[model samples]
Target: MPRVSFAPPSLCLTFLPLLERLLPSLPPTVRDVDVPPLFREQFILSGYRPVDLSWRCYVLSLFQIHNETLSVWSHLLAAVYVLVRFLMFAVQQGGGILGVGLQGPEGQGFSVDVSSLPLVLYVFSAVTYLSCSAAVHLLHSEQTHHSLFFLEHVGVAVYQYGCALALCLYSSDTGWTQSMLGQIFLPVVAVVVWLSCIICCYADLHFHRPYLWHRRICQVVPMGVAYLLVISPVTHRLASHNWTNTSTLPLHFLQVALFLLSAVFFSCPVPECFSPGRYDIIGHSRQLFHILLSICTLVQQEALFEDFLWRRQALVREFGEERLLLACASFLGLTLCCVMTALVMKRRTHVQLLQEGR
Candidate 1:
């Protein structure tokens, strides 16, 4: 037998500090005053990561204490969970690009055909936005912040379109679907969503810290219009729904409430506003917004899934397969337009950065 040798305690102690030094350490964070103005958060005075860190350091910062840590992990984990759930659902239905059917209330079977395209698109959009948000939060540095911010705006535009597409196809009441608004809703929504992205990017580019009010207005107005337009179907559905049938009603209500509350937190910094630096590492408004929005998304998904199962046959027969494919194709076109807009804005941002000697 070979004798096993263990290092003595003294020898181990001597190497401990050296080993620690050899390993990558968490980068030191700075105060709001120390970093560039673009990196500072309103009412957040400390725990700001330095602007000029290597890509590896920023990736490592995910596990370290910083203002964006919670923001990053919150949406990152939500995206992963949603993706895993979708995969599991697909496996259960049938291991294919298109599943046969899903078991619904009381074990009723509903067909999954091209009619399922909207649901798939909505899930893809949700994952895209959530992943994009996480990436923006994780990799945001002075060098990449502008391009990433524009990317985030594009994600929002895509998500809005996704929600509109699903609600229009699946959740709208029969009466509403036949109404005038429904006839022209999707085309108008596509344009509005693109405009919202452009407005958001423009606001960020032109407005600095002092023009916060103008920036907020420019950002909020277009988004509010797009949101109202996209959510009209759901609003109409909820209002016209029979209260006696309480199956998916509660989920709709919960999703709406969560979304509204999240908007409040997103627009206004709370607990942190009251006491600066107190919530820098925890319990900030943005963190709350991310959590609430994620929950809202999950609830919305469940409600939509239930609605899809209940109305699949009617939807397919009424709209026909051609219309369904057309709607999806139109949405794809809108996605391309939004991506182009982001790229153009990103190029403009790079030019501006160079001009400013950044």
Candidate 2:
């Protein structure tokens, strides 16, 4: 056998350039003026990845420095972290694949409960929305931007339904639950959430750059309605309950505050608007929105988990098995409706793009 020659570290470093040359390179990022108006974020003056690149290029672009890089990684990491934390919590609680168990009153042994179902659904929705948001950032292309936008809206609708479901079941006080509005809250929320998704998609399709305010109003109004409906229970609980008695109340307040602050960033470009080109690579309003929303989700999850554990028995007794099942089923149906709505909107978007091309 011929003597084998081992390259020293310095000599190995010399081949790094050649190795890099053999691999595919990321597409060059473009300035706002270089891309179509549809892809240009307001006040984000640079670091846009070129449009019409291959899917592989878009995926590879995740590692490259660009405006959407943080948006993609923030939610992607959040989804993974949320999922892992949930699974760890489930395992620690001695839960099965479907639900978690807690020790019963009077020294009764731990038992698997359907009361955990809403919480489970909430976690599922959180993961889904985070993943969808990440995909909207990562896989965005000129051809499919409308579809991704619709998908993100659907994800938001699903998440809103999840929060409403959990709050309705676990967080609402008995007085609130028995109230007229609470009786019909979930049903109304389902309608409003679906409408919100539709309105957002329609706004995206109909309004271009010049009609920015019109589009924002269309998108924000339905969402505001849905949010108010969903948050009503939390508001009631906060108002009625004794402040010093509950540990989770602070988390509820924190989540609400964080979400409201995030909405500001979502609606307006801040530091970027003031110093356009400087924030292109980082610290933009959208990135801040993503970060704040992720934290809000975590805070909300923690508060809900506490409520679920403390009130699980009361909730089960009050709502009964049939009502709980119905509530979960309604949410599932809402999710299906939102998805169908997105698909329809996506098809319309594709047709419009084709017509525009023609």
What are the TM-scores, per candidate, against the unseen true structure? Answer: 0.89, 0.90
Error of 1 at 98 (Å): 3.3
Worst 10 residues of 1 by lDDT: 93-102
TM-score for predicted model 1 compared with the true structure: 0.89
**Tens digit per residue, CA lDDT, model 2, 182-277:** 999999999999999999989988888745688989987898789888989989989888868998888998998998999899888898989879
Which regions of candidate 2 deviate over 4 angstroms? Answer: 1-23, 100-112
Model 2 residue 179 CA deviation (Å) reads 0.9
Per-residue error for 153 in candidate 1, Å, reads 0.6
Give me the overall lDDT of model 1. Answer: 0.86
Q: lDDT per residue, candidate 1, 232-304, as tens digits? A: 9888877988856856777877887898899888889997999999999899999898989888888888887
